[model samples]
Target: MTPTHAARLVRELSQPLVSGAFLAARDRERLLEVLPSATGETLDAFAAAAVAVRRARIGDAASLCAIVSAKSGRCGENCAFCAQSGHYATNAPQHPLLPPERIVAAAAAMARRGVTRFGVVASGKALPDAELESVATALAGIAALPMAADASLGVLSEDALARLKAAGLAAYHHNLETSRAFYPSICTSRTFEDNLEVLRACRRSGIPVCSGGLFGMGETWADRADLALTLLEAGVFSVPVNFLSPIAGTPLANRPVLSRDEARRIVVLLRFLLPDRHIRICGGRPTVFGRDASLAPMAAGADGLMVGDYLTTSGGMPDADRQGLRRLGFVVAQAG
Candidate 1:
């Protein structure tokens, strides 16, 4: 697409949202058609449009979140970018599920730093019945903090979800990781449909869903757009966008990290497609942008962040992140 054509397309997309109308599905398809070739001035136009849409839709109240890797390592799946996958022999931490107190203690620390959502993430295909009880206990403690207690405990049955929900589970996170077409290339143990069912269960159970994908895994722009569209179709309320950090000993160990411009454009693209959803920058923020420019995605259009240590990588310091977001003119999302 020509620069002028891309500019006009972005303007057209924004004008509808400006006038309080939703973007047409056909226009989103048109944006996808030009997204692969978007660069230079076209990328700039996309970011500007994304910022406008984000401001109009969600304002400047930036959301902050953190996660506790409650149960780590020995993952049954072989996702290519994960360090904790049992299929790979990396140096990621491994442990049984932590006690409820430890999980709540971690959540409390982050909550004190202004994190309003705390997720309990595990590494297995699904939380075993025994671990579920422990996590349920943790959920109650975290909920007592009056924070949103989320979980990413793989594919769970609807019964399991109901149990957690009763224990105060506020949302469930299960990343599709990539597009359906490209999903098999990264993971053979599970299908894209398997992940979608988890989201479906969340919807059926009346629990909010937080789902998105990991970019920079040698996928095409088409794959990225497909994942975003799938998340939208699934009706996920929050989209946690993760760039690949490329762990050693995994299949994608040698894959290059996404360029800063490309990463920012990915955020901008999601903000456009998911105009009303919480477009949160998660796991790969520090890996892709480092500390100095860690907040770049926020400037590009993301309004939520997963602060503090990631599952297997260093993350932005919670206090520092709060200060940084304030400097960027964002009011950190307050506690409930």
Candidate 2:
């Protein structure tokens, strides 16, 4: 594509987004088709266009959120990138669910650091009835902290999600991990439909949904675009973009980490596609960019971040994340 063509396409696609409108279906399809061919200065133009939309639609404040692995390890699913799967023998921690008070205490510490959202995450196909009750109790305490109470407890029914909602659950997270066409290669224990069903249940229960994909697991640009479109179709409120960390003993242990440019491109693509959603940089930020450059995603169009430790990996300290975001000319959202 010529420079003129690339510039025109970027403007055509980004103008609607900057004005708080969506592109027509054909124009959106054209964006997915054209972006893969964008290179050199052309790609830079697309990135800049994404930044414009982000600034206009989402503003300059970067949101900070944290998650606790309330229950770790012993997962039955065989997602190839996870360290907490029972199919792997990695050194990830394993334990039953933590008590409600302990979970609330973790949130309290993060809240003090200005994190406005706290997720109670567990590693399992689905939490048992008893464990769900415990998580519900924890959700109540977390809600009292005046922070958003979120969870990623895997596939759950509408009734179960409504129970948590009544207990003050604010959002439900269940990542699609990747696109439907590429999903079977990454996981076989569960179908792609299962992931969608959980997100749908979240919507039916009136809980906001946080769903996204993991990049750098050998997916194509088309796969990334498809995942973005899927999240849009699912009507998720938040899209937590995670790159593959390639944990040891898992099937993807040997996969190479995505380069900084490629990771930025992923964020830019998601920002353009889901301009109005919360595109939060989550797991694999440190793995892909390291601490010193952790704010690169924000510069690329992301408006939110998952600060502190992740499920099975250490992450950038909250203080550093706050400082880095400030250096990037973005205001950090504080707990209200």
Candidate 3:
């Protein structure tokens, strides 16, 4: 399509599109159709429309989801992109599950930093019953904090999920990591369906699901689009778009870094697709997008962010993130 035609297509998409059933069919179709035509100004216009839609749906509110790697190292699964798993022999910290009080203290610190949601991330295929109970106790200890709590303690049974809910956990995060067809290439221990079932269990237990995938993991554009659509279809409430930060000593250590433009484009497209959801710029935000990273995504209508350091990487300081949000006229939503 010519630039003029692309501009018109963007304008047409920018209309006050319905986010519910009224435009569901058209919404998906339009997103798919405009994706190939996505370019510099055209992508920006689509992102602008997405931001407007998000503002209409969620207003100026933003959620701060903070995460702690409660248990680190020796993960049974070999997800090629991760540094925490021992399968690749990376220099990840190998430690046993932290004490409940220590975990609670970390949550308290995040609460003081104005984070509304706290997540405990453990590296493994699944936790044993004893370990799960320990995680539950840690969550319960942090329950009195005003912040909402979540845990990515690997897959869980119905009873385990219920235990977590009872312990004041409000949500569970388990990224499919990639599309179904591409999943096996990343990890052999778990199927894509296995991850989906965990998400389903969370939904059935009335817990909100936060799931998304890693980009630039040797996946195609179609693979990336399918990952986003799958998250939408799974009713994932929070979608974290993580660019693959290839860790040294891992299988993908020599992989090339994703370009900033490609990363920004993916975020913009995701915003257009999941306009009203919490499209969080997670994991490799700093390493991939650099300092000006947050601007385009926030302007494109991201509703939340994973603040502080990631599992094995540093990020922008909390003050910097807050300042960025303020500069963009986005208000941070405090815990009630």
Candidate 1 per-residue C-alpha lDDT over 1-336 given as tens digits, one digit per residue, 9 for 90 to 100: 678877898898787775556657798788777765678888878888887888888898988999999989989888889999999989999998889999999999888878999999998899998788899999999999958999999999999999999999999999998899999999999899999999999999999999988999998877887898889899999999999998889989999999888898889878877888899999889988988899989988889999888999988887888888889888986543
Regions of model 3 farther than 4 Å from truth: 16-30, 33-37, 334-336
TM-score for all predictions?
0.95, 0.95, 0.93
Q: For each candidate, C-alpha RMSD in Å?
A: 1.8, 1.7, 2.1
Candidate 1 residues lying further than 4 Å off, grouped into runs, are 1-6, 20-22, 334-336
Give the alpha carbon lDDT tens digit for every residue of 1-336 in model 2. 789988998898999899998767788688877776677787888888888899998888888999999999999999999999999989999999999999999999998998999999999999988788999999999999968999989888888898999999999999999999999999999999999999888887888999998999999887888899899999998999998999999999999999888888888889988999989999999999996688888888899999889999988878888888888778886533
After TM-score superposition, the amount by which residue 308's alpha carbon in candidate 2 deviates from its true location, in angstroms, is 0.4
Lowest summed lDDT window (length 10), candidate 3 = 14-23
Worst 10-residue stretch by lDDT in candidate 1? 15-24
Q: State the number of backbone clashes in model 3.
A: 0
Comparing 1 and 3 by lDDT, which wins? 1
lDDT value, residue 214 of candidate 3: 89
Reference-based lDDT, each prediction: 0.88, 0.90, 0.80
